[model samples]
Target chain A: MMRNKALAAPFVLWAMIFIVVPLVMIVWYGVTIEEPIPYTEIVQPDGSVIYQLEDGSRTTEKPWQKRAVFSLNNFRRMLEPTYLRLLLRSLKVAVITTAICLLLGYPVALILTGRDFKRPALWLLLLILPMWMNFLLRTYSWMSILENSGILNSWIARLREAIPALDEWLLSMGVRRRIIFLYNENAVILGMVYNYLSFMIMPIYTVIEKIDKSLLEAAADLGASPVKSFLRVTLPYSLPGVLEGITMVFVPAVTTFVISQLMGGGKVPLIGDIIQNQFGKSSDWHFGATLSLLVMVVVLAFMGALGRIDKDDEPHKEVRIL
Target chain B: MNWKKNLRKAYIGLIMAFLYAPIVMLILYSFNNSKSRAQWGGFTLRWYHELFTDEAIMGALGTTLSIGFLAAAISTVLGTFGAIALFQMKRRPRQAMLSVVNLPMLNSEVVTGVSLMLLFAMAHIQLGYVTLLLSHVAFCVPYVVLSVMPKLRQLDPNLAEAAQDLGATPMQGFLRVILPDIMPGVFSGFVMALTMSIDDFVVSFFTTGSGVSNLSITIYTMAKRGISPKINALSTLIFACVFILLIGVNLQDLRRDPRKGKVEKVRIPY
Candidate 1:
């Protein structure tokens, strides 16, 4: 018992210091207003401002007493159209990315599980190799590829002469044949899918592979088409993995700021980028907290849904990846 | 029957093409002699040579490699023991424990990153290599646990029983029987954690302080400023290293077939 206590103490202490307390602070800072706060900020669209409170209390004088005031002004600000837009944008991006990832990753996973592919291990290795590269570089590499006049566009340009119809189609789309992708929604969504798709694939592949070959064969024997067998027996058996993979991908992609900032030209704002901007630039911990709280609510709702879906006490069967 | 077969073939090809496209472009462009990153100005060995001697890049490389090694070593030791302990517990408590271990993997990187940043602040300490190592270990432990526990659970309990029956101590039985059986899982877990730590940017970015820069941080800074040619060179080197490790891991999986390889590996039998 004493030995157990000794081992457990460090872990308990570590979580207290590292995980539990910081979580407390995020909630706290999210509620408490901070420096350069929204007192009387007015914006004229082209960078002019007559900034004063609606109450007309102008203070160039530093008020020491008001320095650490905690307030609901941040939470109230969520009513703004801008914050609403950011939340909607983040949700849209996450939903589309998850959908695309499922579509792209499912077929790949199915192939990995299905027999007859020579050297399936090699294919998995190929899938994971880029994944092991430094992530920031991976995101930036998209920049190099998607940049106007970059390698991709240049390739398209070269290909265009050889295929005149392709060149005409590219021109008709208001895109230079040299460039099909650069600084757009497609780039941002594709980047997220590229990074997190493997997380989705690996788990689904594990589940699909674990499914009994006999079960699949039996379904076919019962006069079901191959696709029907997959949709009925295969898909239902693997719903746990789908739920797991979606949650795993959704939470991170929705909350991440780096990919959008680098790839999306910062022309569009997601809740993540907005929250980061508030804290990093505006120094508004309270509003940032509100944003964080919103993200937390969305995440919690998803978790709640997942909990209900997985309410069954039976152990979800494991599917070996081989 | 024919359509079923045809669909599978087409599906396999499409999947292969998608997986290979980015990597093929990456390798092809690395050799492009173009000073402009977009236009391929023909092939050359210039960037590869340039990558060899760049001192700051080399420093970041060294920092990243050492951090990966240290973090993986620490996580592996902790995780191996944690796996053993958890395996000895009853199923209900074990399920709860497993969920706790998987938390870091499931949580958002931004949440983890921001929370770690707050953690460093509340502790009132400067972020440095040590801070980075500690955070990496906390998360890496979970991954190592994920990899190790499955193998531990699938282990044949009777082997240890047989060893004990032969008059071996509990320690001896475990060391001889269970430990060897789970070693591949441990090794793979270690490799996974190592790759994760080395390649990670979000966690490293939040935790790392001055003089603790790594490869991804350097690239992020470069990207923010504007694109650079040296980034391609640096990335190419890192990609080459990752690709080699990836191929090595896949080769292990291939050779793991009992009929083929000398080592008859034990897997987590589902």
Candidate 2:
């Protein structure tokens, strides 16, 4: 057994390099700013200023020699209104998405686990099948449906054409010919709910399905009403699952850029969109890392709180993966 | 009472509709003859033909598959051995090690992607296939370890010792007895890793460069610029493949053991 412990050495080393060091690199990039080294400008007889570099090399208008130094400048920049708004928007969207998934999913779980269903597995498979499709393609599908002149609006147009009275009523009610559905915060949230609904449903369903039927029977024997029995017995037992479901949905929903990009049509920018921008259009890795750290902190804090609440519960029956 | 039961069925039906509406829409438009996305455009197989002929899309599909297979295979070996080693350790260290393993999973995908991008940048490793592959394996090993750990905990510790006590050496005992018991967990872990690698987009986006991309990246760039019926065609084919693959895997499981297959199918990680 002692000798067997050596098998972990290779993975530990790999983890240190890939998993641990990369995170440290984020911190290294996050809190630092690049500043030009002090240089003396020397004017030559020809009127071309030969810049004296930090290393004492003379050059004709050489680009500023910038070096990375520890600073909280990025942190301060993160506190600015633009970034703060993005963070708030991300949280707002993530919270609403999670809430909607729970409200929509809990009942679905309950129904699936109910005694009437002879084959819940088949139905559950249908629920999860959409996830196996490519993520981008799924969002693109929503784009087709929710675009300004897309399927929903086209159907509305056809309806108004068939019924002129309905058209007059809508016109009198101050409704436009085409209602804008995409490119808004609501659209981003809709896309998120569509994608992550399964994460919420799966865990809650697992927990509810595992409840001992005898417990519900005992509650009934004591003359508890159906709702009362569910509130007391089923709800408490499934709390861990609910927490797990929240963690799973909330984490991805908060950190997502693609759903927002496609669904929001680049109009509604979340913190994720901004972080992705830093790496792409912005080209400021320092700022990107700073934003990444903020997201990391928020996610860790959320999971840590959930962990504390769930500490006394039994370990989760299965490990979750995307 | 009948109305109440009807209400439950109605609710489930509505949720299923919400879930599958997008997919059905994609499938519908994939065969549209006209290039415009909004119009009905008579049904034809033009986009499907285009989908098969497009070099960039096919190249991305190739890269996605090769990387997914390699990453899954490498992570399974490393993770299986790591789980075994962790199983042998004292409880305190094991718990600490497990938390470190969990970091990549628990952290935001954007953060994980960005951090890997930074790591590659700092280390002078070019952001391409190698970096992308490494990042996938990094995120994947944790899932593999987690899936295998539960199985290891359930195994009888003395079985290996008993086999050794007979005539077998330690390695032989492990190969003959312990390996067979834990093979299911390892296989599921491999499947999980494969799906994860294939499905990953956010991490791959940040950690890849130099004209190398996977299917998700290709779809994203194409969608961002404008809608394309070819994408619809590609997605339709991919969706069909996924549906068939899942059904095939499930069917094989059912043939092996009806009761266990149902449970295992339900146990598949999200």
Candidate 3:
């Protein structure tokens, strides 16, 4: 018994140092501010002249002389309209991406798990294989495909050159010769869905695949049509996976900096872009910590709600066909 | 019924295309003889040659693989032992520990990255290999724990106890009984940790200093200056390696447990 406790000590210590301490540091930095530059008047060598102490503070000053003070300034800055808009836009884009992924992925998952589907594992592996590639490489490839004068546009140009009437028709429609696809919110969402669609598919596929076929058979025996059987038997059982999928897609979509940077071309700055700026270009750690805290709270609240729904479905496990 | 079946198959085909189109573009463009991604001049292996010889990229790849392996191996040991200890612990303390374990998994990656950056800044620790390794291990442990915990829950509680009762020492009982039973979960956990570590960018970006950059960071920095086709070649090679490895593993599993492999058509759930 004592040995078991002893064995746990190292991990516990590690968690406290790395996991617990880092979070505490974020909170600490978030709610605090460094002392602003002190202003003082100094007498110059010429008695009539006065000097301002701008560049240099006293070298002998105690470290506590420039103490960090607790402040709500960082949080207050977060409420600025620009920052708030970015947060709202991030949420909107994430929500849209998640919705699109579910719409596109759920059907794919269902079909992949179909009774007649052969070699489902092989198909599933194919779906997941792209994800193992470097995420940056994946997004960069999208840039190559979607950029103005890139593959799609060049193909369109070729089509127009082949058919003069097509060129005239496009000109008559007031559309530009080249369609610009990058550096916009739509491109960011496209990137998100592309990168995260597999995440949505995997979880929902796992859940739907686990559904007992006998339950569907039972539903059919009761005269339930295929759709009705699906509604009653499959949908309810797959809710946990759906919620899991949503969390998986939505969290990353909301928080991804690289996707927006690469695909949006820094034109559509999300909250993630802003937070990254604070740490990088802006160099405002306090403000960055505040934004991180806000994102953390939102994610936790979202997961907690999903977790409740998961717990409520626990009693229904016995109804599983397996 | 015939149409419904055809529709299902077509839908799967379409989604597969959607997922694979970018990847296919990447692989194709890797062989393009042009520096411009927009134009395909001709087919060539120049990028592959460049990929092999680029010292910066090769160094980053070395760093990434070392970090991935080391972090995964260390975290697997910690997480496996941690899971076993927590399983034996009382409910309240176990719940508390488990939640902490889940924190890194559930939190936003941005938050995790920023918080770790803050910790290093406050502690005045230089953000380099050690910080990178620590952050990787910290985040990777949760995945390991989650994987191993399920296997621990499924074990017969008295398996180890029975071995002990048979006059085996407690450590011997654990080695002979519990370890073998949990090997599958441990193996998966290690793989999961490795994948997460390798794929990581955001946490590694912030936690690692400029001198110590991983492949993801290298790619991100290169992105601003237009990603070279060498990256595409490298990715194509990686994809091929993983694909062959997966096929090999599946074949091995079929050989070892033919019946079980046939019974469970879908071997991995997540």
Candidate 4:
């Protein structure tokens, strides 16, 4: 037993140093403010400069001196209306993306696991193959297809040229021949759904696949309709997968900077973009840390709610899929 | 009933098209001669030729492969051993350890990326290949642990004791009895680690510096300036390689258990 514990020591130490400490550092930086050097004029030759402190204490300090202090200023800044709106928009986009994925992915998963479907593994492999490509490159490919003068519109233009009446109707409806699809919130959502739909499908497919066929046979034997069997048995059983899929999609969707940057073109900046900017171009580590902490708290709360749903279903068994 | 089946097939086809349109465009544009994505001047193999000769891209690809290989190999050993030790622990302590292991898997990539960046900065470590590799290993360990734990649970606990009773040493028991049983899980863990390491962008972006970049980073930086057709060519080659590799792995698995090919479930952790 003693030797076994010793064997795990290195990994435990690594986790503590890398995982635990970095989290603590985020919280610490989030709450603490770096004291800026006070502006003061040198009126005397005694090496003293006057500056006002937070407590309104007038002090004469040595030139170029600064002190760190605890403050809620970063949190206050995070609550500003601009930041709040960005957070809200991010939530909205993430929710829409998750909903769309569930609608599209659930049916696909059901069909893939159906009795009539052949070569399910090959189809699943096809679904997962695109993920192996560089994600940025994948998102960038969408640009060529959706850009105003890109493939889709050019195809539309060719069709319109063949049908003069349809072109005239479109022009009369105040629609431009070239539809600008990129650099908007809709484009960002489309990009996200394209990237994350696979995640939603895989979990639901696994859960539905794991459902014992005998249970459904028994339901049919009991004279229950197919829809009734589905609702009573399949739907309830797949709640865990649904919750898992939601977490998988919502978490990344809300926090991803890459999709929004590539698709939004800096116009529809989300909270993630702001957080990334603070670290990259803005160079405000403290504020960035605060935003990260905020995101972490919200994510934890979201997971906690989903976990409660899971526990309600299977109270005794500890179900951890991920 | 026939129409219902046709409807299902058509729905599957539509969704598959949605999933594959961007990928299809990437492959098609690789053969396009024009530098502009919007135009198709002619069919040309110029970009494919350039891809082989581009030094920066070749260097980035080298870094990505080496880091992925090293991270996966190191994390698999550590995580396998860690899973073994953890299996011996009491229930409460084991759960606690497992949760800690899962932290990296659950946390947002951006947070994990920035936090590691901050850690490296605080420690005064140069942010380059070493830092990037360390962070990759750190994140990849949790996946390995998760993958291996399920297999460990499926194992027979008394097998090791049975070996010991036959005068076999602990090391001998582990190598001869335990290792063979857990080979599938270990293999899946290694594959998962390698895939995660290679596909990673956000964490790698934050933790790397001194001009050391991976394929994802190179793509992202180039994307800002409108990605060249050479990238399209490179992506096509990569897709072909992965397609072949997937076919090879599936064929090997089918050879092992021909009847299970259609119904085999990939044992992903989540």
True contacts kept of each: 0.31, 0.62, 0.65, 0.52
Residue B259, candidate 2: how far off, in angstroms? 7.1
Per-residue CA lDDT of candidate 1, range A130-232, in tens?
A: 6765666677777776777676667777888889998788788887555547567778888898788887887787788779989988998999998899899
The reply for model 3, stretches above 4 Å from the true place, is A36-66, A163-171, A308-322, B251-270
Please tell me which model should have the higher DockQ, number 2 or number 3. Answer: 3
Clashes of 3: 0
What TM-scores do the predictions have?
A: 0.82, 0.93, 0.92, 0.92
Q: Chain A: TM-score in each candidate?
A: 0.81, 0.88, 0.87, 0.87
Q: Per-residue lDDT for A23 in model 4?
A: 81
Among the numbered candidates, top lDDT falls to 2
Name the better of 1 and 3 by lDDT. Answer: 3
* Model 1 chain B poorest 10 in a row by lDDT: B261-270
For residues B102-191, could you state the per-residue lDDT of candidate 1 as single tens digits? 556655666666667767876787999898998888778877777887787677766766777788776676678878999988988898
TM-score of 2: 0.93
* Candidate 3 positional error at B147, Å: 0.5
Model 4 compared with the native: what TM-score? 0.92
List the candidate 4 regions with Cα displacement exceeding 4 Å. A36-68, A308-322, B251-261, B266-270
RMSD of each: 7.7, 3.7, 4.4, 4.1
Q: What's the lDDT for all of these models?
A: 0.72, 0.86, 0.85, 0.85
TM-score (C-alpha, index-matched) for candidate 3: 0.92
Clash-forming residue pairs, model 4? none
Give the least accurate 10-residue stretch of model 3 chain A, judged by summed lDDT: A313-322
Q: Which candidate wins on TM-score?
A: 2
